[model samples]
Structures are given as C-alpha cells and as structure tokens.
Target: MMRMRRKVLCLDWDKRTVRLLVARVGSGRMTLEDAHAHRIPAEVNTDDPAALGGVIAAAMAAHRIRRRDVIVDVPRDKSVIARLPLPPTPIAELPDVVRFQAVKELPFPVEDAALDFVTLTADAERKTATEVLLAAVRKDVLGRIRETCAAAGLRPARIGLRPYANLVSVMHLPGMAERRVLFVDVGPALTEINVVHGGRLAFTRAANVSVPVLGDDDRWQSSRLVVVGGGGEQDAISGAIHDLVVEVVRSLQAYRATESNVVIDNVIVAGHTGVETELAQALEKRLALVTDLFDPTLPLGITGDRGAELRGFSAVLGLAWGLSTRGLLELDFLNPKRVVRRSETIIRRARLLGMAATAAAVGAAALTWSAYRAKAAELADVRKGMEDLRRVVRDARDLTNRSAEWDEWQYDAVWLDHLMILSRALPGPGREVIIRSLVCDSSSSSIRVDLIATNRERVKQFVDVLADLRAGGLPDEPQDSSRPKLYRVEQGSWVEGNTAEPGFSGSTQVMLRVVDVEEFHSPAAVNARKAERERFAREF
Candidate 1:
C-alpha cells in the first residue's frame, strides 16, 4: 500500500476537477505550477455522496493514492456567510454564542449545517470590543462535498465556506486592494458580494445574481472587473458585469463626500482573463485602474503551468494552502482530530455531570437521615424558644422575615471583581448568558466560576476569548490599575484526546483586576464605560 498523503480535491458544481497543491507537512501551498486537471465522466452523479467513491477507489488502484482526510469547498450560491461580533476574551467562553446568534443572523436556518469560522482580523484584541468573522456553509451543500469524499473512500474533514477561502487567496496574492475593495464572485447559481479590509473578509451578502443576470449588486465590485463563469451567457453576463462597476464608482463618490481622505485606486477582477479585460476597461474609464482576477505569484512561486492551475480552483487551493501550516489545520476549526477530541470531551463532561448528580442524591439522602435524628433532640428546645418568640414577635412584627431576606441577598452577592470585569464584557440584552455559580474567596479574593453551557466546547471557547482580552491589553478596569495588570483564564479541567487511550488534557479559567481608565475613555465618548459595564453584568 502506498503511504497516505494528505490531499485537497476540489470539484465545483460545473464538474471542473482540480487537485489543489496541498501537503500534510512542510511548505504546503497553492501552486498552479504542477497544475493537474481532469474532466469527470458523466457516468457518475457528482452530487451523489457515494458516486465519488468509485473514482477514489479507482484512483487508489491506478495511482496508489490512499489518503482519507479531505476538505471540501461548497458552492458559493448555496452557502451563506455573515460577520458577527465576538465577546471579549474572558466572555468568549461561549464561542457557540455566535452559532446560536446565527439563526436570527442568517436568512436561512443554520441548525442543520456544518459550520467553520475564520478570524479575519489578526488583532483579536480589536474583536474583543465588537464582532469576529463568522462564515457558515449549509449542511446540505456540505453533504455533497462529504458524499464525494466518502464515495472515494475518504473522510471529509471540513466543508469550508467559499467567500472566506477566496478572500484569503486574494489578499495574500501580489499587489494591494483598497481598504474596502468590493469582491464579486460570479458563480453559476449565485453571485457573491463581500467587502475586505485589512486583509480580512468583513461584510458578506449574496443574491440570485445568476439566473438571466437579475439580482442585487449594491455591494458588487466594479462590473468592469468581472469574473465570468463557464456558463457565460454573453448579454446577461455583460450587463451584470457593467452594473458592478457603476455601483463601485457611486459608492466611492458617496464615501468621498463624507471622508475625503479615503482613496480607492482601481478595479481588480479574477476569472477568465479574456472576459475580465473588457470589464476591467469599463471600470478603468470611471475609476483609477482596473486589474485582472488574482496573481498567485505572491505566496506560491508560480512560473507558467503552476499559475494556470490556480485560475479555476483558487478558493479551494487557498483553503488547503492555509491548512498546510503548523503541520495541521489552522484555526483548528472543525478538524477531525480536534472534532473527535471535542466530542469525547462533551461525552466525558456528560458522564461527569451524571456522576455528580448521582453523588449529590446519595449525599442528600444521608443528610436527610442526619437531620431527622437532630430534629428529635432539638424539638423540646425549639418548642420552648417558640413560646418565647411569640412575645418578641408581638413587640416587633414588622421585623419578621426581614432577616431571612437579608440572608438571601448575602447569598446572591456576586464577587466584586467578577462583577466589574463581567459588567464591562456583557454582550447586551439580545446577547446574554446566565451564570450558574460564581465563587470568590471573601478573604483571599480568589475567583472560580462554574457555568453550565449548551455544550462544553462553547464554554471552552468563551474562556479562550477571555484570555485574549488581557493579552490584547484591554481594560482590567474597576480593579487595581497601579502598575498595569491583565486578567487571564487559568487552565480549567480538560479531557483527553484519545478514545480507548488517553492523550493530552486541558481546561480554562479566568482572572480579573482593577485598572485606571485614562486612554480608554474620551471626552466625547461614543461608548460609555457604565453602559458597557451593564451589558457585561447582565449576563452574570
């Protein structure tokens, strides 16, 4: 048997077969240099999950290729991606908060889907205050990719979103796009519109800009910089192409009126060079300069044939390219090993929770028996005290039960430090969490909180985000700010990765302190510290 090599196989809805330049280890990237392309014979159903199995089996028999893990790029038309805010690193424990938010966020339901996320902003610190990148691809579309991989005797690892993959490939390539360069991806079933700035995919939206060239193009790129698909219906395509450039120029004009400092140099289109040039010229007439699709020479040293291969599978190729780093998948988003580990973690937590419940029941039974014994002995003393209390209650009737209410309030008091940090980190009313148990040592000021989550993975993610906040030099406000301090998540209990055998285990925790709010505030503040404090505390 040949050694299993990690490979990325991309087959679009149009049956364009592409083997992206991806490696399991070493310098893996996208290169059109070793461009390999083949036409899938119609004898197989491309949409059928099991249909691709025959081809995979055939490839192993013929070429000795025997890898199982696969990454599929879903079609743009069928997928939806939205950019949403992420909480401060500490509050980030609920990473799945975004997933829950996606239901209201996406036009379609995201529950029956396999999703992945990419942090477009390198500085997660900036994200601590607002939103993070959330790209979601529907499960049905992902199933197609999974089906193809399974049929070929391979396991589909992640069905990556198309827009994110394209954005990564576009930004990494040679030359610079405007701060908010409009990205228009004209696919067969749909047209994708996105705005990228600071090398991150920010705003994303799509419309049925495919059928007979009818749809929304308000956010589309300069129509002149068109990326014609294989089904190029000349008139429909050209008209759709022209509309984008017009919108781009109009957007520039509006932007200039408000902010004269901003500059948009030109239009850059990628697809068929022959079809793009005409569109590029149309854009150049109105704007600065109109460029072609993408030049892959930036990351991948493409000379001739290498560059050609990327012309079609740039997005898929880019996803596989980003994965090549660190000897595994980047961001660790929905990776199999990680997924298996995460699933195991969820199971272990469930088991632990059940065990704890059982133990508590047993302990409660024991306490009940002990209390019964104590009650018999205390009955005579309580009767004598009750008789004396009747006289005292008549003297101070209003004070009755007030002591009990005071005791309950004392029990409900949250730790001051957690209260301070959490108040600053709340996700607002529309986004909030109910904290279960927040324990703080009154004397030592040590804090340990336990939160019940819809899933442990979400809790773990929230903790990770909290850690990022301090790392980003964010405020540790309402706490000590003398020499500058930063809060961090102390590692919590983690589960082992192995199923039958155990491997690495991990956990997450949090720490908060007081700080001065000098540079953090402005005289004419857009964000009030007190209001933000309320938002964060609302969750706790």
Candidate 2:
C-alpha cells in the first residue's frame, strides 16, 4: 500500500515574531506549500498562551492551512545540550543512562526536566563505550509550549531545539557533509554558533548578539557619495559584527583544543535579517575562514526574492524534514503519549474490522440458509424423480463445502497477527537484540526467525522469552495455564559474525511450529492478541 504524504505545519516563535511553514513531506522529499510570519508587539507577551494562539490562528487562516500536526522549535535560552560518554550499553538502556548524566550535568533538578538524547557514536571494536548528544528542557518550559500550541487549535506532535533544527537544515547543503564547518545563525536577538564535525553537532553556543541596522536607503546612497560620510554608523555595524566574530574565534579555538585532527574549513551564515551578507564578509576577513551567506532554500530549487525570505524558515523546514525522514535526532517530549494514542487507534481499527467481518459472516449465512430452504422445497417437488433428487443433494453439499472453504481462507489470513505476536515475543528497545529476518509458512504452520544481539547471553534470554510467549506464560495471566500453547520450538542454532549492527557479534536462528492454530486464527483472538502485542511494543 502506498503511504499517504504527511501535511505538517512547523511553528517557530521568538520574542519578536512567530513564523509558520506548512509543507507536504513524503517519498524522501519536502515541498513548502505555504508560509507566514506575524510580528509580535513589544507590549504583548509572547509567552501568554492566548496571545500567541491568536497570532498563530491568524497566520494559519491566512495561509489556508487547517493542518493540526505541528512540530515546534523551542528557543535555546532555557534548554541545555550536553555531550556525554557512556559505558557500552544496549540501546534500550540509554534513557536511564542519559537521565543519570543529565542529573550531573544540568543545573536544575532532574525530576523537573524533560530529557532526550541521540546516540552519536558507538565503539565497535571494544563494545565498551558510546557517545551521545543529550538535550533537556524544564518541564514548565515545555508545558507552556504545549499550552500555547494547544490554544492555537493545533496539536503539537514534536518539539525540537532551534539550534539542532538549524543544523539539520544546513547539513544537507552541497559540500557540507564532507567538511568541518561552523554554522552561524544570526537572529534579531541572539546568534547561534554551531560547530558541525563529521556531519554531527560537536559543539554549540548561543551568543547574545543582535544584528545592527546601518541606515535607510537614502542615507546609504549619500554615505557612498562621500568619504567617511556615515563612518559612525558603519563603525557601529562593523563593531557588532566583530563581536560576533570574536565569539566564533573563541569557540573555534576551544573546539580545536580537543579535536586537533578536525579543522573548521568554512562558515555558513543564515538568518532573516538583511545584514547577513555584511556579517559574512566581515567574519571572513576577521576569522580567516571562507564565509558565505547560507540560503537553505537553494537545494529545494527555490529562487528570487521570496527565496531569500524562505531562509528565515530553515528551522521549521528542518523539523518537517526530520518528521518525514525520521532524522537522527529522535527527541520528542510527546512520544510516550503518542504511543498510547497510536495503540488506541490500532485497537479501534481492529474492532471495526471485527465488526465488518462479523457482518459479512452473518450475511453469508443468511444467503446460504435461504438457498437451502429453496433447494429443499425443490427437492420435495422432485422427490418422485430419483436422479433429480441426487443432483440436488450434491449441489447442497458443494455449497456447504464452499462456505467451509471461505471460513478456512479467513483463518489463514491471520498470518499478520502471528507476525505481530512474534514481534512482541522478542526482546526490543534498549536491548542489543534485533530480529534480522522473519519467514512464516501457513502451509507448514511454522515460522522461522533470525535474531542478532550484542552477546550470547541476550540471545539466550530472547529464546527464553519466546518460550514463555509460546506457552502463554509471558504476560502472567491467571488463565494462561488453561490456554492452549501456540508454538513449539522445532530447531535452534547460533552463529558468530552474522549480524548487521556494529556492536552485535552473533546471530541466532530459531524455527517454531504453530500448535494451536484454531485459537490463533480466530478473529476475536487475533484482535485481542494484536492489542496486547501493541501494548507491549509501546512499553519497550
């Protein structure tokens, strides 16, 4: 089945302005369908949920966007990002590990923070250490964000950090992935300096530096006509740009001290302000690094004056791209709630399917009963003719057999449900174990699964879990003892160096025969099993 393209509205709000971008993302591509910018008055508080919601609603109405799926970029002022090294652990255990690191690194209380992390690197040789990028924002900060978005008649799906969003927006630029570069986003109130090395964020710092306005067009023309006509104004702008460059230089020096092998080759300046060109030129001369104004819209085939304005929406575009492509930054404060909602949706869908199937069965039975009654009436009339009576009996038997065959076909269609069960039976998430391949044969009433794990112990644990699930003992149900066992292990084998993940050293092959096919194939049983499996999947 072809997947439907996602319509996403990305919102970025600062003290001065609220920016909105609506786009359709699918098939590894994103198209900007509409955009809007609303300026907030200084007298009005942007933090006020009602005030902000009004502005967002106006923008959405202007753009004719009714999409409720919104991804928001929160400001960096109240959030913290840290890079930490952890002992080699399974991916499932990273949350606890990150929370521990956050407790030591963050200035605020860990209990009051919403935390997320991305794995940057894992040591394959030793399998003893891993590096991660950790991000945390206070719960209240996120609560306000949610409240504002909610008031706007929008459902906030994901919250992203602005700097990280900027990084993703520019990372795909031509020649950027191959080089270590500094991404300087010069905004109205603050400038973000991000050092990206090897296509990953190595360091980031927000400097409280605003772009300086030089003069009006007439004043600029008069100043160009005479030497030192607007020297003071020019000097002020230059001075401000110099301060930004100084910060960049300090950051570079600090980063170089730790990573001597990687050198920053260039700088990319991006923002909505018109001073970006001047700032880029000034930084190039002062820092001795090749600098250019970053136009993130270039890769999207956008040009002209409007393309320049699109530069301001880079962070929102990045957020949409991440949503479509499942980017590296897997941080989402709303993920747990989303999981619950998704499970509910799945259960509702299952119920609807069950209702439809039952209706179909009832209709089929009604038709068969009417046909049987008519055939019996005809048989009574043809009782005097022996040959006719035998033919009518044969026809009735054939119709009954066809109905039985239809039911059998329905039973065989529960293979997908069995696959769901097998998925639930495995160890997942933070565990290093993964299922490499699954092959189910309804004819043989059997399934074969190939699994990989970081070590042999995890593989053994996986087998035990599968055994428990087959015996209906894994969920600890009181009725499990009476329920029929669903599967019997037919064969098992383990091999080294048969896995794809870098840290995993071995793979296991297991084959199981379906023992209680009747219960597994029942529509109600399948639905219940699927719901339980989905719940387990969410927890892990």
Q: Least lDDT summed over 10 consecutive residues: which range in candidate 2?
A: 218-227
**What are the per-residue Cα lDDT tens digits for candidate 1 across 1-540?**
011224454323333232333334223434332323233454666566576556545544444444566665655556655666654532333356656766777776777755555543334554343455555656666566666666777776665666666666666665654355655554433545555666666555554433232222212221122323344467876776566565555545654564467545434554422334465677677665544555565566545443433455556656666555543233223441112224344445555555654555555555777765554445544444454554444433334345445533443343443455554553331132234456665333345664333334555555554544532132332332343333435645543322221221222234432111212323433155446445544532
| Candidate 1 stretches greater than 4 Å from native | 1-33, 39-66, 86-92, 108-110, 119-129, 177-180, 207-240, 243-266, 272-274, 304-309, 326-540
State residue 309's C-alpha deviation in candidate 1, in Å: 4.9
Clashing pairs in 2: 91-430, 92-430
Compute the lDDT for candidate 2: 0.69
TM-score on alpha carbons, each prediction: 0.49, 0.58
Q: Candidate 2 on 23-88: residue-level lDDT in tens? A: 887656677777665555556578799888877787677667788878997666768988898878
TM accuracy, model 2: 0.58
- Top lDDT prediction, candidate number: 2
Distance from true location, Cα of 476 in model 1, Å: 51
